[model samples]
Target: MKILDKLPYFIVAAFAWVAIVSSCANQGMPTGGPRDSIPPVLMSTQPEYKALNFSGEEVQLTFNEFIIPDAISEKLVISPPLESRPSILTKSKTLIIRFNEELKDSSTYSLDFKNSVVDNNERNELEGLRFSFSTGDVHDSLRVAGKIINGFNLEPEEESLVMLHKNLHDSAVYTLLPNYIAKTDKEGNFLISNIAPGEYHLFSINDLNNDLRYNEGAEKIAFADTLIVPDAEFHAEADTLTQGLDSMLIEGHTHFSPEPFFMRNFTENIYEQYVKKAERETKYKSTFVFNETVIDSFGIRPLNAETKDWYILEPNEEFDSLTVWIADTTLAANDTIPVEMSYFQLDSLEQFYLQTDTVELVFTEKKEESRRGRRGRNEDDEEEEGPEPVPQFNWTTNLSSSNFELNNDIVLTAPQPLAGIDTSAMLLYLKQDTLQTPLNFNFTKDTAAWRTYRIAYNWEPETSYTLVIDSAACINIYGITSKALESSFKTRAEDYYGSINLDLNNVPGDVLVQLLENADQEEVIREIKTDEDGTVVFDFLAPDKYKVKVIYDRNGNGKWDPGSYQDKFQPELVSYINEVIKVRSNWEWKHVWDLTPDPTFIKNIRDKELEEQQRKEAEEDARRESEQGTNQRQQQNNMFGPGGGISPGSLRPSGR
Candidate 1:
């Protein structure tokens, strides 16, 4: 009873404590006064910055405000990089850097702390805090700056390591660490300061292992064609990759040659080619997946079975996967099958060697009762006992509607590969005003697909046509016959379609112009090669919005080839015309596409769209990760607590 009576006193005490805390918080809270726009100011340094002949392992930098030291390990750039990273600790408002390894004597050392430290109150970053000292009397003070981007998409590559190597051999990137290094920002912009004046080989790599050296076949790289010499003269150069940095400014010396050099990064096509896996997903389908593209010279054969045309070989467009459909039912019925797979394997010195391995293909399906029962139910909701339904012979066609498109073929697709297709049982007739007349048409199976057949005929616009197929017209490999099908559909009127006449400006003739259904390039609607004058006409496009991409077709293969670095070949250059052609009925849209390669133009057009798309995907990914309890993201709200992180919405330093 006495404790219950003291509840009022406790409540009063809590209220008093909250008032006192709120009074303390009010002093630091924003109150419409001039916002704290300035970053933490440097007060002094231990051993003083730029002290010569100093033999010390510890350096201290005191700031005007209490600063966080958490991001030092990641954002610090110590050139000539320390073999081991330095440790950073804070005492009151001063940060101390302790070297873990011995520094090279008689050499200039630069400690570039790029926006790692932030003020305690506002969390404002101290941007570009650079300190330099030399064991001897000399200090290097030159730099180089550039932007890195993906060669294919022109997308800016963030966090890419830009390296400067004095040893200009091609093997330097393979065996040695960079003399000086800087990481690209979100806009792919990088600035390496306090570099010694000398000619250097500049290269950029994604640095997958953070070993500072570019591991061929494991990393994407970009390099300068010519040696770059750092200078101290301020050469005016505009940042071309992005406009995001206009919001913030930075104090920098323009003592760099080729300011803002555009580097197009590319990943080599040489990766270890191993048998990724061998699996039999279906009774008749056995698939072999390779880690890299199958170079058309690979071979596979059954280890203990007949090798004479025992299976049908089907490779995907990328040639990375091969589907082996069993021709012999006896072989497919077996529970497991062994096959010898031979493919090219890469060596450490970039030489190819043939590797053979035995792989077992296994598949077994467990049958279970259907969770989804019959559509109709009994009053008691009991399982209805009835005769089992017969297996259906499944087939589909492109004629989904009565109004068929003139540009489309009446494609017939089976659920499984076909054993035989009898075109003699199929009939097509053209419907006139009242009478119908039989027409000659070619019904042939597609070379690439075993189960797909197309009925090709001269379809007259605004004319009705009738197609009839007998019950046994097509038979699958499983001995199931197709059901009888009949349909009367009318070809769309000529006015219902649209036409596109494209003039490929600045492009050579015979270039392939592909009509893409979407920006992702998952599906290509139509493809046409330009004429000798770089002109092409697509006369029968349906009224729909479409995107256009041009394939250079350098090898005259008529298909876009993903290039090989070992062969010194680049993927057929594809240029996307950055506009959606909204075709309306009875319209002829003529457009002149500029095929000239302008990465800056593409980057500018794609920046907002890419950011929006990535943001949506990142949000969805974050939500899914959070729901799955696997997200490890940690936020540092250190104003009233302790955190070393400077996250988004925190005060970041100016400039990319």
Candidate 2:
């Protein structure tokens, strides 16, 4: 009752309590800032600042801000590492490091804080902060500086480790930490400070295996032939070391090696007829058998059955042997099929070699009879039942060459010798630009079974010329009319010519050079190989600017191949210098290319182009959607506006 009488005082007390609670909630709230400003900066260390004869088990460091430890283990590195890792303690911005093992009696130790210490707020790293302590009276402060380059391209290889070893043995790097070590930056520059003056072997390693050691099979190592140290000034130049391919490893162990040669024999005189019919009819069965130990896989090259021809077949992949299956009807009854087989194998020097062989097979009469029985009877039996007429032999004109330049001499070759043909019945005409001209012919025998007649005529440049053989030009042994054939080709002008010269310098002693033009930019101009002088010349090229490239054919295989990663084989490093030489009329452009070192600029350009293409595609898609939306809106307006039978003024609001 007495408290109720003092209501005004009680109300005042309650209001004051509410205000205090609201003020406390608004003040001192967690705003995600550090508990204190000035993140962990090192002030001073123990042992009285560079005091000599220091043999302390515990070292204390004072900082200006509260410290949190996360990357202490990875960022901290102790030179001549201790048997065990040290312990770090944080007590109110004071970091204390306690050694867990005994140190050498009179040795110097350096602690590198490699981006380890960071502020708690934004995780700002402290760079290049190191502390040095010595048990001896003197400190080793001598330094060395240099750059690390890739031996292949003479370009700086970033993040490469440059190490110095007191001993040059293989196990030195594996067992002991480098006496002095530094990593190359993006510019390939490195500096090792506080190195003890001594004779040391210096080398740079890619360290792909992360073992901190050199493995020729897994790592690229650049070593100086001589020793380097703090007292002696030296520079280390690196070379790209290429590992050879091992022949012991086989690729795709499933198939046998393909044979280079195969043969199909025929008894009947159906060479031309069978070739024409076989091209349309895909019936035939052929099997290939080869040495499984010598090759990996094989394929058959296309052949001309009418005229005994030779063709080259390339292998698909690496294998000991390969078997190919072909249909039997591809050959005539008396035709012989010639084949070339390609094989791949590793040589003793750990290099790959492509081996080729030639083989042949004869088509016999028995095989032809078996094929006829396998082929079912056709509907043509009704027409053949009426009368058995004498088979008519037909003669056809086949130009031995299908494609030719206008500068080349025109030659008409016949399949058979013209002995019984009437000379007056033959008519040959050559025409160009509506101008008909008669060509004088001179007959010459090529071989015992074939003959050719040469037609002389001066071809005009940049003009399409056609040769026509009228019907009944020559009669065959069976007295049939010859089929008329026509061929046409446009002549190249004198202005369409150019040349290029390659000058290679500092080439390896046993390397072969191959020059290749970008096919997408130009037609198949030509391919040339370099001589011992490392020079290749390409003449009579069509007038065009082309992308030129070269390959250091290390194995003399006459081809370029990408090396394998598992075998520790670096690819055949190709280079495109990006120098577009314009080949003009009557111009001999000489390009001095030194392919001794590989180039990576082309790869960079290709990657950039790929990114640009992707970006353009995205932009095009956005534009296409915008256009589609515009078209849809226009169609909707046309359907509802004036002429579309829905007047704008007559339309009313939906709510109304």
Query: What is the TM-score of each predicted model, taking all chains together?
Result: 0.71, 0.40
lDDT for 202 in candidate 2 is 68
Error of 1 at 310 (Å): 2.3
Candidate 1 lDDT, 256-283, residue by residue in tens:
4566687777877656677767889887
For each candidate, what is the lDDT?
0.76, 0.54
Which one is best on lDDT? 1
Writing each residue's lDDT as its tens digit, candidate 2 over 581-646 gives 566777887767665654233222133444678999999999999999999888767755678644
Q: Which stretches of candidate 2 lie over 4 Å from their true place?
A: 1-42, 47-51, 57-72, 75-77, 82-100, 114-125, 168-171, 174-177, 208-210, 232-656
For candidate 2, the per-residue lDDT at 42 reads 82
